[model samples]
Target chain A: MINRTTTAALAAAVAAAALMSSGANAQTANADKERCYGISMAGKNDCAATGNNSCAGQSKADYDAKAWKYVAKGSCATMEVTLKDGKKRMGTLAPM
Target chain B: MPAQPDGNGLTDLQHRFAHAVLQAPLAVPSGIRHDVRPTRERRFGVYRNNVKASLAAALAARFPVVARLVGDEFFTAMALVFIERHPPHSPVLAEYGAAFANFLEGFDPAADLPYLPDIARLEWSHHVAFHSADASAADIGRLAELPPEALGSVRLGLHPAMAVIASPWPIVSVWATNTHDATPEAPAAGWTGETALVTRPHLDVLVQRLPPGTDRLVAKLAQGIALGAAAEAVSRAHDSFDLATALSTLFGAGAITTLSQGSSS
Candidate 1:
């Protein structure tokens, strides 16, 4: 007993809802990830861990050891690494 | 030519300043003059030096091993030649050295170090892998769950940062020795070619020394070749190709990012 126009509108609404959910899922996935510091190799850092330069590949020393790169959620501690000060510490989600 | 105004309009002034910074030191561009009390030419020289030094530092940052191989003086001179020819096209400095390895191949002074170009290539690859976009590791468990009949037609996608460099020289060893060591030693008399696979699985960018025929496997898989077909191709090329070991290595390195079944032909 539904009219053609009503059926078409319902279909469009369902499609829009699906698209919104997918977009939300993608955002959540991205948010779940974090940048783990003190693990990236020299010239391989994702971006600035030190506030000096606003670019990648700017680490002054090999394993500048304080620089960071992004890793998946809950994977930061597993990347236990040695820092520039010769202290072995696990990577942190927050910039060190 | 008639002497243009000491400062043309804003647009002309900007153009002249840009030229002065990138090209020459004393030849301060015609339409622009420094406001400092020091001679205009001398003040302009400071800007000129900063531009050249920073760009050279960028090159050194991008190719530290290359700079280390050739001493600082030679590396800076060579970097200047490269910077002049291939000025950065983008604001992103990490992407600046795409042409450097090829430039080294034709550089006359570096002719003695024949392997320098390949070494540069390796460094560039490492640079690229460092900044490449992140991707979730492929679900190998799902790959294993596929039916045997469906496995032959499955294509794999590699992580965005993965790259394979096949070189005729012992470039991988040279890179490892120089990059990780303060006092790099020369390679032993007996040196052989190396194939390297660069990837960033977790947060660390790794340079793995790959065995023979493995680079071909990776290259094929990257091109969307089915797993079975890529393996067969490698076997055809190398009689001793080990499929199990290759797959294990790929998974262990977290190189593969996605797996999907290809339509059977």
Candidate 2:
């Protein structure tokens, strides 16, 4: 259950994740299912795929079976990050 | 002589992270370290909180039943002490709590129940075995084919994950009562003593309560004593020690593997 403080924190995290999600579809599809829309990629593997709109893929279902599917309206935008050991790798990470 | 910004190495980062984590509690010097105001200090606080929670969860993982035994408040206190004293030495979180049982032994609050620590030990042993490297049991067909003469002098090899623990307390029963859904009994009394065998034969490691005298034999085998000598020791400990039954029980469970032939060492 997301509390007031946690909900706010998650909101910020979701914002951060959304900004990072481009080009992550392939990686997100294979990752856990809790993720509504994630840009999942590791190392140099650059690919994208969708699980399902509700939460889609492994991530959506991974979190909970009862979670409803999300029908994305606009050109899909979600959240992500590119961590390189000690620092954050900077790039828009948007879908091309 | 020069303040070169070129020194950003992992060592520097580790030190920074460690300091940040330790000092997080002090942030509320006044309603929180916003003492470092306009600073993303909140994020730093959150990060420190996360670190503490993760380590606490790691300790809890090694001792779930212990957590249940102590209650959340006491468990939190215990976990805080364990983390400060035994921060993980390795990056692998799965293999984190070897020293926990001992820590519990020395823990002031839990010291009252002398048996608690040993039960923790048994649990930690279970955790390690669960993640331990897998080795298929030695082929039974080949074992049986070996010459009968070879059996007397054969040195039995235990799988890497085999662990045997003997505690003066009835720890195995205590551990079983809590971890498994069984009828709760009165607080244990007959400290006639207990011994446990924790071994990973395959995917799941089994923790079983062995007869009183079985530990000496298993310990002897663990120390590289030949099967015959180990048998001799167990027989001496308990006149009724059934060598055939015990050996077959272990062998059937994939507990015993690899027999070295030659002289009983």
Candidate 3:
């Protein structure tokens, strides 16, 4: 089950812009100034931490922000969810 | 009511109610489920809270400027109302907010800013096009090999993800003031015409405010007219249509390819 933290909820709203890094997944020059989150698979929408606070979708961003807040405060929980499809087969959200 | 069953897990009725809460804003009355928190604020299930959070986030994503315009609290409430009416059909959350601009138009609360709907649309278009498929400049060498005289006759192809929209309301300007990094200017005085181009070239998605004749020219070309004919059509309407500048721009932006010089059929 997704814990759904409030901090993540807020950050998710803020994470609406420029989620895509450049054409290549390379978080080259623009990394320090801007957050460049990476996705290992474009097909599955998986992303890596670019250290930038901004993520793309509000729900995912909010969830991530809440998780990171704990990291900022030196205490974050390992939040997880098993996504269930029509057959009810579930899978966990891989860590970013 | 008969003894409301406890919810260590969910029953059929509980599942149905939980799904509704998962999808929209609703008063989820409780007697069954409970929260694990020590304070124990039980509004029903985690499902309800998750639904609101996700939907609110979707609204914020779609209308960042609108959220900024109204401030976060007002926008959250607005989004809640929106989510109640329109839960997403597809799992693609990015495409979920398509109806927001229209909803805001009829939304009694936002009646004062009559142009809000159009502005929302412009923003939504930007949002959608921002994530659309965009490819780098194709082998321009193919076109480079074509003869100069043949340039106009060769049917140009637009970039895969380029799109355009024209609004009677000055939406591009409104969106810029609300979202861009440039020096802010007062909103465009009146709802004079405005046109926008949404295209992803290479990696960045660009939403450009087109010049006066640019809309007509792009619109004509979007209808698949050859380059010469589209340019001629715009030049006929506006004497100052600069064929050289426009062609260069569309090509560079990946909005046009294979410059067609052929006669309009």
Candidate 4:
């Protein structure tokens, strides 16, 4: 059951949290960062471009896995992975 | 089979059209005719391509990190198979891909990376939080006004846009490095797990790596557990659980939307 100490602790935590949040708000208020768009890699744009051919699928890849090979070009390629069996190896998107 | 007009002719036509669009595989629907240079077969292929491409684009937007993890070609191929199996039920493209993580779990080609599905789940949570309805944060001043005796029964209403994900993989780190421009060093060796908090407090959505044991406490609170009881339960289970830090994290994220003093007795 909660008693005086627990309640006091709660009060203190809430007060501290409030103070920290206000500071965070102030920091963000002056932040120079703004969201940018349209700079993503080919075919990875956040929204599709609407045009006369808007509904047409422009994707070069299809459902056949044999037609494509893992390129290991993304950031995931650089990461090191420790598998479930305790063996460590460099990460690749290719099927093992 | 070509669908013939029945009492519900429009519905049947729509069904056939959808089936042709998604499931014709390599063949064009026999019902279509083309008078232009492009044959009916070619025109149908274009239409089919457009449907899959646009939907794949939609999934790419939602799961950019996943796209980056595997290259574009593989991601598109995988997405096509997924799209054929799980087309969007709603017109809102944003609502699509709810089952993407589940699909990735059983996806054979990506089976080598066990953490891929968790990453998809993390991305989906971010997408949901980004689109959730906005609500004003609970006024901290009012919380301060409550008497100390009332603290035990404090019930917190979490923001509608808040979600917590606990994964045995370093999902947060992987998501961050892949999504952001400044590539930080990859997650270090011997890393065990990470718990991520996705919240949209105001204009932008925030994804934070939560402290250890904080997710447990937050999960309890999310279930409508009273603050004191939730804290006590988590503390009993996690030796390192800190009530103060947990409360601070929740409040800082504007995750607590309403606070009420329940019956103290």
Give residue B83's error in model 2 in angstroms: 0.9
Model 1 is docked with a DockQ of 0.04
- Residue pairs with colliding backbones in model 4 are A56-B50, A57-B49, A57-B50
Worst 10-residue stretch by lDDT in candidate 4 chain A? Answer: A62-71
Proportion of native contacts found in each model? 0.03, 0.00, 0.03, 0.34
Candidate 3 lDDT over B216-261, as tens digits, reads: 8777766777544555568679876555445444554556544445
Once fitted onto the true fold, the runs of candidate 1 whose alpha carbons sit more than 4 angstroms away are A1-96, B1-9, B34-38, B185-190
> Compared with the true structure, what per-residue lDDT tens digits does model 4 show for residues B6-119?
648667657677778887564554444546646777777788889999899888767878887887889999999999899878878879999999999999999988889999
Which prediction has more favorable DockQ, 1 or 4?
4
Instruction: Give lDDT tens digits, candidate 2, residues A1-93.
Output: 223443343234323333333223212111222312223331111112333321111232222222222212332234333444444322222
> What DockQ results for candidate 4?
0.16
After superposing candidate 2, which stretches have Cα over 4 Å from the reference? Answer: A1-96, B1-5, B8-10, B23-43, B139-146, B186-191, B237-240
Q: What is the lDDT, from 0 to 100, of the residue B106 in candidate 3?
A: 81
Alpha-carbon shift of residue B190 in model 2 (angstroms) = 5.1
Model 3's alpha-carbon lDDT is 0.54
| Top-TM-score candidate index | 4
Give the per-residue lDDT of model 2 (tens digit) for B122-178.
888877887777877664444455544455556667777877778887776676555
Candidate 1 global Cα RMSD = 12.6
TM-score of the A chain in candidate 4: the value is 0.37
- Angstrom error at residue B44, model 1: 1.9
lDDT of each: 0.71, 0.57, 0.54, 0.69
Q: Which should have the higher TM-score, number 1 or number 2?
A: 1
